[model samples]
Structures are given as structure tokens and as C-alpha cells.
Target: MVNKLEVAWTLATVALIAGVAAYSTVLLYHLDALPAHPDEYVDVIGHQWFWEFCYPQNVSKVGCFNATYDPTTGATTGGHLWAAPGSVVQVNITAADVIHSFNIPGLGIRLDAIPGRVNSIAFTVPQVAAGTSFLIQCTEFCGTYHGTMRADLVVT
Candidate 1:
């Protein structure tokens, strides 16, 4: 009976240790995955299959500009995403319709856009030329034109 009890205790202890290790690994991974303090906060609103970007000036200021990108010339006329190379840009995303995903393959980042909820992802702009462009697509299937939902990320 004593031998059987010792075996059971040993098994229980090992299981507990494994569980703690697994939990710590997950905690550390998330801590590293999240972003640091952001230099700018851009609000991205996802519609049925479209993406609308809004850039706010400051915390107290209500004035902001809407983003409109030019794919042909890789130029932004009105107000688009403009950031320096190697700058941290934190984007807060929301959805007006179904679920959509903001995936930037160049930056290796993807975040979900949920209705009535804002999800944020912070990433550093890579060192590239002023006219360099990247594609932003929706990874999630929202509606008919899920494949056509795309935009250009022009780094300045």
C-alpha cells in the first residue's frame, strides 16, 4: 500500500510541474508578442469588406483625417498612413459588419477586426524607400468580395 501511494504522489507532482511550465511558457510568449508604447494610434474600421482608416492628431484633439491610398503611383493624396522607417505604429481595428482580418505580409502581422470591439496590433515600419508599397488584405471571410478587400501600405 505504501509503495502504491508513493507512485501516485510522484505522478501527481510531475503533472503539476508540467502544468506550471506550460503556463509560464504561454505567459512569456504573450508578453513578448504584445507591443510597447506606441508613437501613433490609427483607427481602422472594417466594413462588410472594406477598410477605412482614420488618423487622429492627438489625445485631446478631435480633428482627424481619413486615409485614402493610391495603388498606381504609390502616393497618398489626402491623408494616408505616413510613418518614418523603423517607427512603431499601433493600429486599433474595428468592424462594422462581420469579422475581418488585417494582414500585412510584409510586416508579418495579422489582427482581427470584430464588430463592436477594437483590437490593436503594433508593428515597426521596415527600412524601405519612400515609394515602397505593401499589400493589406483581409484574411477572414466576411462576404462576397472577401478576396477583393485589399489596400496598399505605402511607407514614407
Candidate 2:
């Protein structure tokens, strides 16, 4: 005859694993779900040493801008990732050159930027004061200048 204690322990372990699996399944589904309507959409293109942001819905001319980082002054010129406070912003990310990882550590946002394939992620901007900025960095080892590849997410 088998031991009763062993059987009980085995059953308990199986039940615990099943519960964890179910919860993980549901969490993964929700994590990948995109918002039905986002307040703003920005196309993020990763390059060798800079980031390019494009707003397709701009009423004026095409809103494509490049962000160049200056290490000395700790400033970024040309453009930035702009969104309104408390608004839902979606970014379509891709790489124009090699693979890159777009990461905003403060917001816990990270996504791969692969060439020819667009990946999208949506996030709600924090209800902070206007002009507040979050640092955007490339986590992937893209090239020689990858360390300096940075941008800013500025609240409009």
C-alpha cells in the first residue's frame, strides 16, 4: 500500500501548481491586450545613436522629428516623445538599423525595436506637472554609440 502522507502532499503540490498556471495565463492575456482607444499615438524609430518620433495625427505638417543627445549639457534637441499628462499614449516602435530596446525605467516600460517589424505598447502618462520628463534609453547593445542613445518623454 502507498503512504497516505505522500499522496496528500503530491495532491497539494499539483493543486498549487494548477492555481499558479491559471493565474499566470490570465495575467499574460491582460498584459498583452491593447487599449481600444489611446489619446495619442507616436511612432518611435530607433537608429544607431538617436531616436526619431513621428506623430501621424498632427493637423499641421507631418510631425517627424529626430532627437540628438548632448552628453556635456545633458540636453536633447530636435524632438522628444511628447504626451499629455494622464493621457493614454501608444507607441509603435521599430528599428531603422539594428535591434534596439526602448526602455523607460521610471515607468517600467521596455520593448524591443526590431527592424521591419513594428511592436506597439500603450501606457497612461502620469498626472505630473507639465514639462516633466522621463528618460528613455536603449537597453540593447546596438553599436559603438549605443550607450549615448537616449531621449526624453516630456509631458505636454
Candidate 3:
């Protein structure tokens, strides 16, 4: 009887450990933990000298698409806009030269844009203030100018 009890205790302890580990794994990747609303668009563009942003646009239409800009002023054809609440925002990120990261702490969005590959991130902003904006920073070491790779994301 003592031996059987010892074996049962060992099995129970192993099961408990496995259950805890499985729970941790799920919590790590679960998107439901994100505090932002269920639907909000967010984007981050990394260039050599500047960072560009596309507000909460239709996710179905974003990806390696061509963008026109002012030749002299260096402005985008569409223009920079703010994210709105209750929208499914998809971010299409790519790099011109080196690797760069798009990070926004408020919305818990971050992704790396590789030189020859495109990466994407999707998140929804649950609620947004008219004038509230999040800060964007480079999470990769690009070059000397990497420190200035910052932009503002406004949630309107």
C-alpha cells in the first residue's frame, strides 16, 4: 500500500507540472490577453531616413502595394492618418535596406520588417481617445540613424 501511494503521488506531481506548463504556453500566445479593443488598424513603415504610418485602413487592401509620394516634399500619396476604434487593422511592414522593428507599447503591437521579406501584425484598439497617439520606435539595430526611427500613432 505505501509503495502504491508513493507511485500515485509521483504521477500527480508530474501531471501538475505538465498542466502548469501547458497553461503558460497558451497564455504566452493568446491574443485575447491584449488590452486593445478587438478591432483597430495599425501600421508602421520603415525607410532609410524616416518612418511612415498608415492609419486603420482596410486590411484586405494592404500588402506590397506601390505608394506614390511628392517628389520634392516627400509626402505619401494617401497621407498619414489616425487609427479608429472598432476596426480590424492589419499592418504590412517591410524594410528598404536593413531590418527594422515596429513597436507600439500602448496597443501591444510589434513586428520586424526584413529586407527581402514582409511581415505583418494585426490588432484592434478597444477604445481610443480623440487626441491620443502612441509612440513608434525601432526595435532593431539598423544604423546610426536607428535612434531617430520614431513616429507618432494617433488614435482618433
Candidate 4:
């Protein structure tokens, strides 16, 4: 009983609405899929110009070092934090100087490191993945050379 043009228009409108709804749903899902905690490390302190990594097993041994903007040419003197794939790693992050952020793009991990308190994040790496490398940058506006705050991370 309905005209062909009207039926086609109604169908087109329904399709458009469904498409938009689907797209928005996906966007929200991905946003929530982002990592909320740090990997297998804990008590990461971010100072004015350096970072101190503390191992869970050895609490007394605090490893202090500088982060490099360039991973390949940067200094490798400090100890590295390594995590295997399909593992849930928890990291307790804090800052001594200003607010900083721990971020790994490939691993989808990003969390803020605030002073006076510790921030925590948990992340699980995918299996047989190509391992991602990331650097920690000062998300907050700190002192001079704030842009240089960085580190390297390998997810295996």
C-alpha cells in the first residue's frame, strides 16, 4: 500500500541511522579497550629529569636512569624492563618533580604519574606480537626541556 519512493526513503534512513549507531559503538569500545595499568613493573618514580624503576622481587634495589628520545642511539646503561606476551603486568607510577605520563602506543598503555601519590595501570601484551617500543613523556608542563622526557619499552 506504500509508495515505492517512500519505502526506499524509509529504508535509506534506517540504514543511515544503523550505520551511525554501529560506528559510535565501535568508537566507544576502542576507547575503553585502551590499557588502564602499567605492565609487570611497580613503583616507577619520575623525577625532574630521570626515572627510577623498582622491581617487585627486589624492593631495595632501585634502578635510577635517564630516558632517551631516541632508543637506538640512546644510552643503554640502565636496566631494562622486559615482559613476556600474554602477561598481565601491573605498574605503580609516581613522580617526584612534575606530572608525567607512561605510554606505550603499541601496547595501548597510557597512565599518568602524579607527584606525592602513586598511579597504577595494568596491561596485557598480545601473543606472538611484533613487540612495541614506547617512551614516557611529560604530559604536564614542567620545567625547561620537558619535551626530552622519554623512555623505551619492548613488548615481547
Candidate 5:
């Protein structure tokens, strides 16, 4: 004595949900997969009020550098995140003290930097003129000077 239309509608809704779930699971898996080979690799260490960038592949000299921001001048000195234009760069991110979120709004890239844990992400640098730069910022509420925690990704 149940209504046939109701049963049909219920079954259709269940099928639609199941299909979406399966698609999402596969999409997420592929999104997290890293490339087999990248042009460059950078180690990004997040501090409470600054960011440290290290290039392990550089063998000539000590590749570690710290980026300090000057609030008065709105400039960053000491070091910068460098990459070649149109190159694929992979960044291994971690935090020294607390959790932080590394974000580059221009390229729509964001990743969490967790203490004692390394999170990796890869992206291609846009084919732009040399010296082109992007602003890097911390989206996480780290500490008192967190707002000043900024850097630049300069294309070399």
C-alpha cells in the first residue's frame, strides 16, 4: 500500500549521492599525488614571525636563508624563495614552533605548516619576466608578530 512514486524518488536520490561520493574520493586521491620529478625542491620552515627557506640541492654554499620583513618599508630582506620561470617547484613545508599556513594568493597556493610534520606541495612557476615576484603570507594565527610574517617568491 506504499506509494510507488515515493519509492522511485528515494532510490534516485540515493544513487546520486553514491555517485558523488565515489567521484570525490577519486579526485582527492589524485590531487594529493606528487609528481615523479620536479625542476626544483625547496624546504620551507615556518617560524613564529618569519619564514626560513632552504635549497638543499645547491651544493656551492650554505643554501639556508631567513626572510625578515620590514613593516615600515614594506620590504623583505635577507632571503627570498626563488624559482625559475615555467619550472615545476616542490616545497616541503614544516613549522619550528607552532602551526602555520603558508599561502600565495596570486597563484592560489596554500598549505599548512605543522610542527614536526612535513607537508609537500608542487606547482609550476608562471612564465613571467625575470625578477617577477609574488607575495607570500601566513594565513594562520601564529603569534603577536604573525601579521608581519611575510616573504617573496621571486622568479629567477
Candidate 6:
């Protein structure tokens, strides 16, 4: 029963399984790794249908406001995210009313904004050209106007 065909197929399956296991181990390691001390710590508080951002690391004046962005100029006019290129930005995420999710598509950040508890993720600002912008949205369905709950991360 152990013909050449059978031996070849068994070897191929073993190789495939080993490859997947190696790849998963690498991914898990990076996911759990901690970044250097964050350059800025931003508190992200989610609401029923909106997002509130506060810059607690500011020295002179701590900025806090509703998230707003300018699409044409890639500028954040309100409490939206702004960080220097190559800076580590750590976000403490939580929700006031219900469950939510804070996600940035470009940065591979997706963490739950749970009630009464805080979840955090650290992302380094990429070396983007001036005026580059990234869109962040809630992946969890909260309520009406959820589609409109969005913000922009401007690298300036």
C-alpha cells in the first residue's frame, strides 16, 4: 500500500502543516510584542454613535474634542489623531455606553472598545509623505449613524 504516490502525498502534507505552523508562530509573536515607550498616549472614548478623542500627553494644554477631519487637505480639525512620522502612538480604547471597536485599516489596528474596561494598542506612524491621511472607523455595529462614525489620522 505504501506506493511512491502515497509517500509523495504524505511528505507534501507534512510540509504544508509545518509551513503553516511556522507562519502562525511568527504572527503571534509580533502581535504580543510591546513597542517602545509611546510618544503620545491618546484616550479614545466611544459613544453610542460617535467617537471622542483626548490627547492626555500634551504638556501645555490637553486637547479633547469630537473627531472631525478634512477630506481635501488631510487635516484633522478637531480631536482627531495627529502624530509625527515614525512616532509611536498608543491608544487607550474604551466605550461609555455600549460595545464598540476602534480600527485603523492602514495600521493593522483593531481592538475592542469595551464598557468599563480599557483596551490599548500601539502603532508607529509610518514614514508617509506630507499630507498623507488614513481613515479609521468602527467595525462593530452599535446603532444608527454608525456608518458615519469615522475619523482621520493625519501624518504631519
Tens digit of per-residue lDDT, candidate 5, span 33-139: 88889988899999988999999986642588999999999999998999999999899999999999999999999999999999999999999999999999999
lDDT of 2 at 18: 100
Q: Against the true structure, whose TM-score is highest?
A: 2
- In order, candidate lDDTs are 0.75, 0.94, 0.64, 0.65, 0.94, 0.83
Model 3 misplaced regions, further than 4 Å: 24-43, 54-81
All candidates' TM-scores?
A: 0.70, 0.95, 0.65, 0.59, 0.94, 0.75
Determine which window of 10 residues in candidate 4 has minimal summed lDDT.
59-68
Model 5 regions lying over 4 Å from their true place? 60-62
Q: For residues 50-99, what per-residue lDDT tens digits would candidate 3 score against the true structure?
A: 56665444565353222334436633343243567655666768787788
TM-score of 4: 0.59
For model 5, what is the C-alpha lDDT against the true structure?
A: 0.94
Clashing pairs in 4: 37-121, 37-122, 38-121, 38-122, 39-89, 40-89
lDDT (tens digit, per residue) of candidate 1 on 66-148: 44444566544443455667778888888888999988888897889999999887888988988677777789998887776
* Residue 22 of model 3, lDDT score: 97
Measured with C-alpha atoms, the lDDT of residue 10 in candidate 4 is: 97
What C-alpha lDDT, on a 0 to 100 scale, does residue 76 get in candidate 6? 46
- The Cα error of candidate 3 at residue 31, in Å, is 2.8
State each model's C-alpha RMSD to the native: 4.5, 1.2, 6.3, 5.8, 1.4, 3.7
After superposition, which runs of candidate 1 have C-alpha atoms over 4 Å from their true positions?
A: 1-36, 58-80
Let me know the TM-score candidate 3 reaches against the reference structure. Answer: 0.65
Query: Candidate 2's residue-wise lDDT over 92-147, tens digit each?
Result: 99999899999999899999999999999999999999999999999999999998
Q: lDDT (0-100) at residue 51 of candidate 1?
A: 73
Candidate 4 lDDT tens digits, 1-156: 889999999999999999999999999887555365454565677776555667765445455444445446664335444456777667778888788776666667777888898777666656755555455455656677665566555555
lDDT agreement of model 4 with the native: 0.65
Clashing pairs in 5: none
lDDT of 3: 0.64
